[model samples]
Target chain A: MPNINTLWRTYQNLIISAAILLFCAIGFITAVFPAVEKIQSLLSDTQQLTDDTKALTAKLTVLNALDESSLRQQLSAVISAVPTDKSLPTVFSTIEGLAAQSGVSVVSVDIEGDTALATASAAKQTPEEKMLGTRTIPFSATIEGTLDAIQHFIALAPQVRRLLRIRTFAITFPSDAKPVRISLEMDAFYQPSPTSLGKTGAAIVTLSDAEQSVISKVSQLPQVSGADMSLPPPLMGQMKPNPFAP
Target chain B: MSTSEINLLKRSGNTLRTLTDLEDKLRVIAWWSLVALLAAGIILGTAFFYLSSRSDQLQSQSAQLGRQIDAQLVKEGILTSLKQRADVAKNALDAARPWGNLFPILSMIALPTQLKSISIDESAHVRLTMILGSVDDAVTVVTNMIALSGQHTIRAPQLISFVIKADGTVQMGVSFIPTL
Candidate 1:
């Protein structure tokens, strides 16, 4: 450090040094750090806002073009078209009925659901939950029937819940049958599996404390003699966190 | 004795003359040392001035930078808060995209009254926690869930956990693996 005394025998140097130190102290607090943080925050906020605005604007534009109810129906149709449910049994029964009605014999049903794969599939299908891995439970059924029966069953497939998707389908037959003696190998997806009451008390897919307490409490409640399983999961997701709040 | 006395007399006379000259040389050297002192001081002062001038320039530049930084920070802070608000709104809107049919079924769980809360994470997993009004409720809820899951034809087993909370809240995590 250069001493003020060395520079001059005058008081001017002392005043100058004091003023400089004061300026530095003020600048240190008031100007330097805040400026850097502001610049960085500005850039980040810009990017973030841009993304948010894009999403908001997109929603707004959509809302402008279509009514909310119709838009929701459109959205549901798009979402439910994929195999989101794991309850392939319902679909199997539906197909079986169609096959039997058409005079076909029913055979073994097979299932293969890779939740990890479903999650990946959801990522491709939905944009928001890309990081939140999607889950899928897949099942396949092999029904042996006549060509006419298989064709009838396939024709009735459109009546299934929109979530059902035909992953794979094939046909085969025994030598004794006529030219169209057919065995149908159909792979279909159920919507997401229903929340279950298992040996374990868990129903929803969360470890959050709030959910667990509710689960524990509900386990004690008497089942309403009979409640349709299909109607519960969707309601469970929507109820105002409490129904039958004892 | 005679030889020693003679040598002492001769050496003593020469030693006095040499001492006189040496004192004179010492004075001369002492006189020149002042000039060296003055020169040393001048060199040190000049170096001090050069260093101080550089320091002043650097400090000025730093102050300027500090001012600039402060300005940027103000701009960034405003924008960041705005963006965060916008994001929350956007997420709320996104959530509206799902079908309402899925939520009601999940809610029919008939959770015990003692359970204080319900929350759902981004993965559609429901969390139910209760201050155990009674352990029976917990057990009943468990049984129903299992039965329902089977009936529902659930593919991936939902994850369920129960934590014995201090407040008697039996904490549970139910992984509802929704198809979508």
Candidate 2:
């Protein structure tokens, strides 16, 4: 029913429509699909980041608590190491007992200074030995005795069930002093204080949520009460920390 | 009509025919739209799967954070009993200590074994295969029954009834109720 030119034009128009539709389909698959995929991945990443933040925060709380515990332990260790002489009277009496055993008359046994101990902390450097510190308290003693008596006294010092060590000793007799009477000056160090026993050390900072949660759980744990940890020759409730280094 | 006019008319006629031919094929647009819809559904489903999985992970992480925060509160003395230091006396009995198991095991060993039983079920019901050997043994067993519960070491048959067996063995089955 159509002329030859009309028929040709009709074919041309149909081809153009097909070409346009095909292009549109290709564009939707290649360009639009990829873009959508990229957006999905970014959204996934955002969710992951949020999760990471929450987890890290919780972890941080646990770490902080552990850190605080460690610090507290350190403080306790330091307090225990501080030298003290609260048991001086007991030590003197023990010395008297030893002197009686040795047949030595102790004319004088006086503390060189006002010495007192707040705690006794012990740290083992090895299974059998410790690097002991009694510097917080220093003492000087004078005794009148013979060579054998002095030796017995020295031996008796360590044997006192609770340790007392002789750090330094000197034997002196003036030019006009009696030959039978020997004068001795000795320095002894006794057990240190456990000052850190009741102390809380510096706290560590935590910024994570997980750390916070763990700390919270630990806080709820039940603990035994009514156990007294006070040491004899008790320290007046006040603990003055060492002055800050200038 | 003039020669040019005839040519124009022919051209218009051809264009109309072509458009008419394409109209039949254009019906396929509905089919393509269906395919597009299916593709969108699949895309949406995949996205939902990924999002749900991510949400789960985030939830777990949040819970962990909450736990950590709880720990912090404990250390800060927000929890009272936990902050209290264990004393030397009770430290020995604390379940946290490895040596605390000694007392419980000792107590178990001290449990009395007066009731005799042939079998015990997982639910702790006793079945007696043999009865009491003597009237005195029966009374003694009953009196001591208070100490029989919670004793896992007693594996022997218990008394169910006072019936005497053909072989002269006494048989009886008894249950423990005082929860000794």
Give the number of the best model, judged by lDDT.
2
What digit string (tens of lDDT, one per residue) describes model 2 on residues A1-246?
466667666466556556666765776787557757865786777666685665566445445646555434322322221113345554465556656665667767666544432333333223212222223123445555654565555455444322244433444322343422323333333333333331122233333454333333333322112122122343323335554644
Each model's Cα RMSD: 25.9, 22.6
Clash count in backbone of candidate 2:
64
lDDT of each model, Cα atoms only? 0.41, 0.43
**What tens digits encode model 2's per-residue C-alpha lDDT throughout B26-121?**
646635755675686577667767776776677676667656654454333311211221111112112111211222322332221222322223
Fraction of native Cα contacts kept in each candidate? Answer: 0.00, 0.03
Looking at model 1, residue A13 earns an lDDT score of 40
Q: What is the lDDT of residue B46 in candidate 2?
A: 79
